[model samples]
Target: MDNYRFILSGGGTGGHIYPAIAIANELKERFPDAEILFVGAKDRMEMEKVPQAGYKIEGLWISGVQRKLTPKNLMFPLKVISSLVRSASILNKFKPHAVIGTGGFASGPLLKVASVKGIPCLIQEQNSYAGITNKLLADKVKKICVAYEGMDKFFPKDKIVKTGNPVRSDLISLSENRDNAMQFFNLDMDKPTLLVLGGSLGARRINELIEDKLSFFKTFGLQLIWQCGKLYYEEYKKYDSEEVKVYPFINRMDFAYTATDMIISRSGAGAVSELSIVGKPVIFIPSPNVAEDHQTKNAKALVAENAAVMIAERDLDTEFEEDFTDLMLTKNRQQELSDNIKRMSLPDATKRIVDEIEKMLGKG
Candidate 1:
């Protein structure tokens, strides 16, 4: 393992980006002198976020195909060709022992190059249903680290390893931070707190739902800590008051988890993974706009385990109040959901993923 070098690529969203960073961070802890390089799409968040994590990253000239036919779709082949050439050039220069793809536009090219070069390559899929990029690269990669079971439907069963998503290291042990969390959000410790996450950019429906229900939430004597997301901050900021804390995005997510008695969230892979660790009684409102509507599938996996409750996007308008009221009134239901979700958590996800990487490289 001396002087081990690795290439990891993923981005476009925090769900993909943070896992790649967590894997890179874990690698550094194991081999302090190890050289880790990140490859990400040019102009994507990873270009900025990866560098902020203290890792060197190169940007690929790449983007995903639009679901609808567009003039931009005409440029897809050229971007793919340009990215593949650049990825090969990168692998040739870095000469890494292995490569990891956490599923993003850039990872497709980067891992394709690494797999063709006969280098050990692994991919981490964060959802219950596989993403388009990972599905295309499935056979080429050596191992697939996953957070959900029954991924055999998407990936080769022999290559699959059910390792959960790596949560932010700072988010662990939130129970111990309860007092600090209360002060952090400046919320009343006596009232039950409801934390709503709409993701970094925001979800239109979730924001609209909250906009319409702020009074309903207030009537229940429920204190709210709402991450309205950057896009909707201006529209929703007026709702912020002594009982409701509003922010464009949350910096202290650990505190948010600790302070909340209930969670209303969009069920992305990262959110589900983190909440499974937080062990809160969450009511998942899965976004319907994603590829394969996988957020709903991600939530369903937990619902089957009795780890959380779920409502489809179409059902939210008609069903949210009744569902929410039932959850709030049932004290044992909260503890039951919390305990079950915690049981499904994999605290050692990063460690387990890296263990597979080591095994792949024959350094296990």
Candidate 2:
């Protein structure tokens, strides 16, 4: 793998950014001498996060085409044109061995340019349902790495590899940190813990449900570790009490997972992958806002195997509290969910993806 440089693109949310970072981290470990550069949409989280992760990143003036006719939609064509030109310049200057996309609008132009240049291109789709960007680039990508099975419905069957999402290494062997984690969160270890996560920016529906039912947590004698996301934190901060530990974000998620007896979460691809590996009993509230309702599809995949329980966002008002209360009280159900979810985990996904890349590079 001589003359190897890497260009990684994808970022609009942590789901995209974290997976790209995970792959970049894996590549760095395998190819320490390889120059890695990140390309992401300007003014997005990746611009800040990529640098924070100790990598060089360049931003392209790109934004998604709005589904509704809006002022932003008018600028879509110009932005796409500018982004493609800029991506070509970056690719030309860096001469990367491979261009990897992790599924976001910014990746569309960048990966399209790399494919045109005949650079080996790979994409990691972190959803059960394919995003428009990944689907559009599917024919051009040399290989497609995915977390869900039956993705041949979206991409070419021969090009697809069912590599589960790469979780943070710290999470893989997370063991025996229950007390430390509870102390860190200032939670009570004597009480059964319920950890609720609704993605990095937070889920408004989930937040609202928690807000309305904050007192219901006491019913099960449960300690709460609730990440209310930045948007809802201010409103939810008032609910923080001795039994409830509330935060805008949890930096050490592995600790939170280790400390908890159960999890309440949105079944995003990354969250599902991590939860499966962590093997915690989960109550999934699939976000309806995502493309193709992929979050619901993801949740169903596990629910079908009796690995998780799904509560629709719309049903949360009437159903969530009751379902959650019953779930928390049922120890047998929790153990069953934990065991079944763990059975579906693919912890070696990072290694498998790297192996595929190396095989494509003919140096494995």
Candidate 3:
């Protein structure tokens, strides 16, 4: 067990990809001699990102089936067959001690193949709702690590472990980075600041809402750190000035979290986990377009706990101003939210997940 081999598979979005990378990082740290390989769908972000994180990865010729009938949908069976063949070949060559899946289309084929080969397998489900791929792999997986409660509906109760999502290590501590954050964003520390996040690619509705509410935010003397995403950065960068800073992406999220007093964000599982660790008062506007409206479900879980505020995308136009105003004006409510959300954070999630992997490999 001194020189173990593990395969980490998942990726379509950062929500799936980062957790896999986080787990890989921990395994590397604890087992320096371990061989880690990532498997993801070809042409997806993981193909690029996993390598950037310093891991070798193999790409499967697979993608998710679309809802409507299309050429891509028609080719789904062929893609699955191809992916299975590739996955089987990979497992045969790599012969990993355990295979870890974080849930995306690529993981479906790989984990399915791994489990069938009788290799030890574990999957991390990052959402309140289990994804189609993870659901399909549930019966076969040795253990299911989940971020939310009540996931037994999708997974077997006997196999479930409520280990929170793996968040990036840099986000765990933000207090000491405040001065650097303030200087980095070039915002006055005396003024209250709001951080707006619209997920990785950016949300059009969120960008529009910010544009419409800029004058209102100015009235409250609120400064802004807006991450409009690369797709919309050009369109929104004109608003950047003394009071507002615009970024296509914030490379240093630790700084961004440390500097902000409050956040307005999409409630993707990754964002929810990171914000909880950041411990800032947040107004979650969950994306309506995702599968199963899971973003809303994820936000509602926190809202039910009084840990965060959630405003559906459909309700944003009608309720955002009042909700935003109420939270901003109530100092005690803000403190309550910050405290509650912080309580929801699982700072050791990455370690906990790796612990599961170790147990699967009999190295626990």
User: Which candidate has the top score in TM-score?
Assistant: 3
Off by over 4 Å in 1: none
Tens-place lDDT per residue, model 3, 1-364, is 5589999999999999999999999999999999999999999999999999999999999999899889999899999999999999999999999999998999999999999999999999999998999999999999999999899999999999888988988778765567788998899989999999997678999999999999999989999999999999999999999999999999888888888999999999999999988899999998889988999999999999999999887898899999999999999999999999999999899999888888887778
TM-score of candidate 2 on Cα atoms, chains taken together: 0.96
Sort by TM-score, best first: what order?
3, 1, 2
The residue pairs found clashing in candidate 2 are none
Error of 2 at 61 (Å): 1.4
lDDT of 1 by residue, 1-364 (tens): 4599999999998899999999999999988989999999999999999999999999999999998999889999999999999999999999999999999899999999899999999999999999999999999999999999899999899999988999999866665567898998888888999999989988888888888898888778999999999998998898889999989999988888888999999999999999999998999999988889989999999999999999998998899999999999999999999999999999899999999998997877
Q: For every candidate structure, what is the RMSD over all alpha carbons to the true structure, in angstroms?
A: 1.2, 1.4, 0.9
Model 3: per-residue Cα lDDT at residue 84: 98
TM-score of 3: 0.98
Sliding window of 10 residues with minimal summed lDDT for model 3 = 170-179
lDDT of 2 at 211: 76
Q: Which of the predicted structures, 1 or 3, would earn the higher TM-score when compared with the native?
A: 3
Over 1-364, each residue of candidate 2 has an lDDT whose tens digit, in order, gives: 4447989999998889998898888998888888999999999999999999999999999888788999999998999999999999999999988889998989999999999989989999999889999999999989999988889999999999999998889888887577898888888778888898988789998888777776777777888899999888898898888998889999998789889988999998899999999998999999999878999999999999999999998887788877887787788998999999999998998888888888777786
